[model samples]
Target chain A: MPGVLVIAEVADGKVLPVAFELLGAARALSAEGAGPVSALVPGQAHAQELIARGADVVYVAPESLAGQMYDAWLPAVDAALQQSGADIVLLGQTASLGRDLGPALAFAHRTAIAPEVTALKLENGRLRVTRPCYGGNARAEHTFAGQLQIASAKPKTFDALEPDASRTGEVKTIDAVGQSRITVLSVEKVESEGVRLEDADVVVAGGRGLGDPSAFAMLEELAKLLRGAVGASRAACDLGWYPPSSQVGLTGKTVSPTLYIAVAISGASQHMAGMSGSKNIVAINKDPEANMVKAAKYAVIDDYRKVLPAFIEEVRKLKAQG
Target chain B: MNIIVCVKQIPDPETPASSFRVDEAAKKVVPAQGIPPVVNPYDPQATEAALRLKEAAGGGKVTVISLGPESARDAIKHALAMGADEGILLNDPGFEGIDNFQTAVALAKAIEKVGQYDLILMGRAAADWDMGVVPMGVATLLGIPCVSIAKAIERVDGKVRVTRVLDDGFQTVEAPLPAVVSVSNEFGEPRYPQLRQIMLAAKKTVQVWNAADLGLSADQLGEANRWLKLEALYVPKVESKVEIIEADSPEEKARILAQKLRADKLI
Candidate 1:
């Protein structure tokens, strides 16, 4: 039986939470008679956790493969796929890694890949995937014609199953092959200030309505107080009001936080595509008819400049009382 | 250093949500009436990257290419108006409804027919499909290394040095020349075309090519050869019921919102 193969991604010596999420997603598809689910990781550090999450078999690439470029990592994953004989492959959508690796692998394998997929299922022996299109204004369902099916799931789209301590699975190591043609002469990591935007439970995103670039400082204060991360719409990022790393939109990063607070964002379809999946949305814009307000769960129809400070103060007091 | 920047024409992303519609039967978006199509927002940034590279190289050509309907010429013209040296339009009935893989195949063929080029550039992703797969696919077909989601790119010591955007921060990577790079919106705002440049661009002829021109057969292009089939396309039902927090003043509104969030256990 052709099983489902998952690429368990590791960052900074720890398995990313999204890896478990991918396993959860793969597990669901495998439940429909797809077959046992297997996982491959570039390093040994996260093999056991993957087994606990639902991987029936775990393949560990050589430790030397860790932190290697996609060119180096591709052959190992390709080998695992061949060895496992898995027809379906799932990967978590990472900013730099999976975005490049998925397409390259699909191209190499002569298969199709659905990137930033939000939903998937096995129907009549075919993998049906759903992803946003037209900047999230609509969703497109796609099915592959090739022998192998691959997709990258957006983070936070599915819940990671609680680890079963009693669960046991076979774990084996595999050799890494291939060399990256690109050279990394230097890697300069920009130090970020607060919680990472993708990992945050709550995100306070600002937009062009902030009036000026410095207005983002107010958003940072509110986000810091709430112990959340600050995000920006494409408009704000395009205006140079904030770093592109903080941008949340179609062309930027897709975020699905527990709570999303939009300050002066007009909620363009492009921006909505990224955060519409948030569990709860709050829009603070003077225009009552703004798309953000229409899509939000709650609305404050007033100038964000006037309301933000008050909202920040109230949240502080609430936390203080606690 | 010759650069080939791929551009695409897409419906204006800012089209109002209510006006946006999809033809379920055709599995495509219905262009909003009266809202003329605009260049995919990111494509301009890609063209900007190409033009800047050409300038920095002291003398090079930036050719903008598009694979779409004849109206897509507007996108190529927009690039030329923005200071690109030339334009190419891969327009053919056979090219219609091709998926990203086939699109990449066609584009790679076009690049080969165009002959020598030191670099290829494209937007991080088209606003329409948002797939972001084409650049890598083209790179793979052309046998070149690809670096994507680049916020900044510069030709350093004859190598393409790119600052790539990651979820957490940024990382700098360098690839050899004749590489493919996809520029992100974060690269900075693209320049606006002046009236004089637009007039000059109107006079410049855009080279038109077809599947035959690229040495591709009908069986090798379009929807039939696409690897992925579009099962359906539709607007998701958004049933959000927004509760307007009305109060006498901003402070009162904040208090009510806070209380409501507490009640809902959102904060």
Candidate 2:
């Protein structure tokens, strides 16, 4: 049986959390002694970090694979699969690059690919993957019969293992292959003002109950003070108070952090689907019976008008003191 | 320059939870009886963009292509009413449970069946899966350059200049003729069909092609090429506590709220 190959995505020389999450899930499957967990880290020299994260072997590309993610990435993934003779491959479901490259790679290799997988298990001598459908309202299970299979794992749905500092893995530098039709003419970077949302340890989200949509500023200020990201309920998004990208729900980004502060949200079940994984939840709302309060680790009953201003001011003062 | 815009009919997002059921044995959602499926929200943007191109191409053809159950004819009719010159519905039981890759394969075959076009336009992603995979998959299958998340596109001279939204902001990419561009909502709001156009659509012929007719079979449609397997589905579990702060004085409430915020480190 071939081993499992995981495509670990690196941007700006840093491996994304999704890469680790996929590896961890692959490790879980490999723990069954099904296969070894190999990784493909495409970059000038980012393969070492992948080896540290859980890979048994790392494939590093010496060229500037950073800019041409899909071009270098696809070949690296394909090469890893060919070398590992791997029957199964795992990748992060959230990457646009992943979504773009996955099907093409699968097609070229004549392999099967399951995407946005929330769960994976071995059943009846085959790999079984579970994915959500109908906007996270239902789950579907599929079993693969092919000797080779690939899957894109959804983030926050899998746990990345703790780093094994003592473990060392083999590294191989591979020659880049394929003439990519896609070319990167130039690259531009956008500067963010606050903590990167994906890297945030804490997050605070608000909903329509905040009265004025402008009240989101208060939540952002608080997030800034706490060194976190500001998120919004779908209700706020549908109401056009926030961009669709910032909407947190089953249809939006899935986030799991140490703390989630939900302000003036009623906690619609769909919205809860995204943030329920947070380690600790705090909700501040005027209505004591709001559904969000029921889901929070701590709930405060107060008008956001009275609560938010005070909260922002206090966080500002605390940061000043620090 | 003739263009084909592929569309899908999906269960409305606002459909009540109770009205939907999961057939775990089959790994599919059973839509409630009497419920209506709507054209995907993104396809209209693609349709609108295509119509504008048709207008600029000295009245070239704009065809709507859809693959779904027979009910998809209703979806195609909606497109016809929105200025599409014609509609083709590719419906077959074989396409059932097909993932993005399979769907793209069947769609590419359907496009081959249509046989003539310069550009293929699609929505960035469909609401049903939000996969955003089909357009890219189709492009790859056809060996064409694909640009997704296109917020704006205009024909300059003989080439297409496309403005696409990336992870951070946006970029302008120029590609020659016969390219695939997946449109975003920012392309423009789709125009409402006039009464005259709706009447014309009623009389227009909507050609339906089955998988067998298109020289495809169930063996190639679903699980056969499926590289990924689904394992399980369940409602996420959530539990929380809410506190309501009540103080007699405004200043007192503010002070207490401030203290609590500081304690939580949200401030």
Best prediction by DockQ: 1
RMSD of each: 2.1, 3.5
Per-residue C-alpha lDDT of model 2 across residues A1-322, encoded as one tens digit per residue: 5677887766666777788888888888888665788887766366666776788888776556644535446676667677777778887764346765665666666555677777788755467787666665665666764567777865676888888777788887777555555444444445556776556788989898886789888888778777898889887987889876677876566888788888898776567667767877877877777767877766667776776676666556666787
TM-scores for every candidate against the unseen true structure: 0.94, 0.87
Model 2 chain A poorest 10 in a row by lDDT: A182-191
Quote model 1's TM-score: 0.94
* After superposition, candidate 2 runs with Cα above 4 Å error: A69-72, A94-96, A154-157, A162-165, A186-188, A250-252, A268-270, A285-291, A310-322, B16-20, B32-35, B156-160, B174-177, B221-267
Clash pairs, candidate 1, are none
- Candidate 1 residue spans exceeding 4 A from truth: A212-215
| Candidate 2 lDDT, B47-98, residue by residue in tens | 9999988888777898899988888888888889999998999887777766
> Candidate 1, residue A182: CA error in Å?
0.7
Please give, for residues A216-300, the per-residue lDDT of candidate 1 as tens digits.
8898898888789999998898788998778898767778898999999999888987888899999999999898998999999
Q: What is the DockQ of each candidate?
A: 0.67, 0.45
